[model samples]
Target: MKKYVRGLAIVGVLTLAVAACGSKPAENTAGGDANKDFKACMVSDSGGFDDKSFNQTSYEGFQAAVKAKGLTPVKAESKSDNDYPTNMTAMVAAKCNVIVAVGFKLEDATDKAAKANPSIKFAIVDSAPATPIENVKPLSFNTAQASFQAGYLAAGMSKSGKVGTFGGLKIPPVTIFMDGFAEGVRYYNKQKSKNVQVLGWDDAKQAGLFAGGFEDKAKGQNTAQNLITQGADIIFPVAGPSGLGGLQAAKASNGKVNAIWVDTDGCVSAAEYCSVLISSVKKGMDVAVQDAITSVVDNKFDNKQFIGTLENGGTSLAPFHEFDSKVPAELKTELDTIKADLIAGKITLESKAQPKAS
Candidate 1:
């Protein structure tokens, strides 16, 4: 048996990435309202609007709605957890038509504000708190499905026979991607009878490397370097902005390593890192946010949960851009077959980290 040298980067190794909820309000108004001042406001997580991941995509969708429906746009950018409630309350005090919270960090704040301001429609990205307030809708995804494919691709392409994954935090939203990634590597090992190793995470134990927060690029870079030093040639970062650091690590490796991105295609979202990105496990937050705005425009805002799964085109593996020729034809065919199997219910992934089907 090949010896497994395990080293876990757990929480608290660096600054505690707790979501402390008030900060200055950053607002955006994209032209005056053409829809009778149908105001739409959004509150970003600590990742800010330029995180180049979830927050960016969510805001982009909101911006798209502002242009498409001629709606008044309002936005508040949070620098920390403190800013979440502060931003939401300000938007509520303004009595905006709809307020979107950009991440799971804002779920608690969003819940309190939504209940207090029942007249306002609320949307939360990446979190569905157990208590369902009629006014707040959750925009979530089973991103694990897509991540599994990325893991398989990494395993198939790795000459080192070692791939790695890590997250900004240990939260379910981030861990779901890691869980699927590790499992996919295991599945690939089984199918190919190869000794491919996933360095960062252990699915059964639900323990692995975490940078403790998403905002620190240095931490992400170090985490990727750690995995690479341990023989990982492919790194999948489930962190938002921190993922950019991992991309930097990979790019600096001079062909020594490649990376898989999360939330949105790094090829486009973080185009600077495309050369190092193998692919991305994308969640359709842009599409979901746009749909939410459309629903409001149609005056049919319900608190129903919007679950993004592969079957719904809400989550998917991106095209193997620079790696198109590098991936074996057989491997690509296998991925398609696996995708079909997953959608057809012939295969099921077991993960407590996925969104609860309510």
Candidate 2:
């Protein structure tokens, strides 16, 4: 009855019955009889294959595509910023049909390697080059839409009537979640005539809390404790693996706090925190990665940008696992309406981090 957890290097496997739990289908890579020799490869950022966040999610998708299509898989994991270029170059040298570069920091490396090896198709996660690269497909998400829902959920569930959020950095990708989260709290206040306070972010000022980096769990834990002390009963962290600190902080809160997660479904990816997980604002890195690999393998590869929106199933709110019944049915219904409204343009989230349509 516990949540699923995937180990480092090895990928995910579901524990519960998918239908009963109301989770979305895992990324599909099953078709394509052509291009059996097509090789799919990836060059990871320093978090490498075990980040369980951006890097791991993308690799999982690429690996799934390799397995389903019977295509060969190749990978090189970077251990530092300096390793990005070297790892990418190695994949290119290996003649990988599609080379995926994980992380926004890999922009230069992906562009450089893509330009040098023009024949090979490329996919870049969480970034698009400053200049148009006709051979590189950019896979990015409008995570704000989903984070908004998490914010609203936190606001409704908070015993203290306050919630907090912090980021790995103040970058657009991270701040986008904060902006939408603040907006969601504000929206909840407006709708319910509640004065729910959102600590750590001010969307109008475009600034607030940030832990500075993705690797420091101590910073994340400290940030969570500080926010909890401020009467915020819930905290959302966009700090990749560092978000785990929020979990530890919540578990130590003497039943006064809960944590919302980002990137992937933390309920599954970080089962150790499942007892306190409110939910996750997921970016479909796995699907996008698999799509990129399959496109090349299926001989339909294009350099078009793939923007993940809630409507397109690219970004979403994960189910309340341990907290399923704890979340009121009425709040769940409202979230469904908000999702449809956002997709229908009846409700809109404004953030520059939103990936543009092709």
Candidate 3:
């Protein structure tokens, strides 16, 4: 009787171990089965999380979606452009139902990966694949409208009557921001009858300082300083990561200078210079990502591209933080009017190849 009892106990232990092993595969497979639960994944560009620009904004969006849907979300950060493909592949292999790639820099890699993994769904920010895949969705922003607001504010607030803009690359998105900014300045000038000169990238020449790369803060600082020395009291740094250098330069200039930040709210993100930042171009990535994930959760994930524009309430200008009191009441009123006009199609912020001279 004792021998029989011991043998039964051993068998029970084995049964429990086997049950535990069976549960492991369920957890692994649970994420991929859309019928059960959807898993979302993201692969970031070389800028990483703290770049204080596109990467951070995109990540925030992805996180919001994950939280809202109660879905498992994974992120693979690329140290360089070369790592994009490999990191993307790893997420695909993990059976992520949806993968979001941040930044235009990941366009090529994301395109290749999406094609290779036909079963996987993809969403990319700031870019669209050349050939649209049925499974991939593109998300782009109307940065022009937001930047135009920044320009209008800068033009109205510039003490020196000169504002400048610098970009890391002359890409369409960056150029669109610059174009809208220039137009805003022109609009402000036309409305107020003031001459505010804009320097740095010329829409006509289609030329500007690249800073060679986006990660070089020193270059950004120097570029901004040069623009400041040329009598630009307000400067817009549209270059990701490098924009921080511009902010630093503005701070070192002893509060006489101010800057406009891009992608995220610089006031909250860069609190040290919040006092100097006039405003920021707001991109609603958080909302976009949340919407994308919700669609997946509700089994309504459609192969539709998302365009975040002013009309859609996907982008706007951040409120004046420390400059709230400094900005005149009249200027604020005028800015509101302009925003309304732009939204209502009363005013069009058209992209032009020629830079209007101050």
Model 1 lDDT vs. the true structure? Answer: 0.79
Q: Mind giving the per-residue lDDT tens digits that candidate 3 earns over 1-358?
A: 0000000000000011111122211232222233335667777766676677777777777766666556666666666667666666666666778888776777777778888888887777767655557777777777788888889999989989999999877666567778888889988899889889898866656676555557789999999999999999998988877878999999999978999998889987778779789999988866776677667667687666677877787788898988899999998888788888888989886674211211
- Give the clashing residue pairs of candidate 3, or none: none
Task: Give me the runs in candidate 2 sitting further than 4 Å from their true place.
Answer: 1-36
* Candidate 1 to truth, TM: 0.91
Each model's C-alpha lDDT? 0.79, 0.76, 0.72
lDDT of 1 by residue, 160-243 (tens): 999998899888888889988987888899999998999989989999999888899999999989999999999999888887
lDDT of 2 by residue, 1-358 (tens): 1111111121222111112223232322223534455667777665557766777788789778877877656666555566666666656665667878777777777888888888999888777776668888888788889988888899899889989998877777788788888888888888899999999888888878877777778898998888888988899987776777878899887678999888888878888888889899998989998998788877798887788999899999999999999999999999999999889988888765666665
Candidate with best lDDT: 1
Q: Give the number of the best model, judged by TM-score.
A: 1
Candidate 3: global Cα-lDDT? 0.72
Report model 2's TM-score to 2 decimal places: 0.88
Residue 283, candidate 1: alpha-carbon lDDT: 86
Which residue pairs show collisions in model 1?
Answer: 20-81, 20-82, 21-81, 21-82, 22-82, 22-83
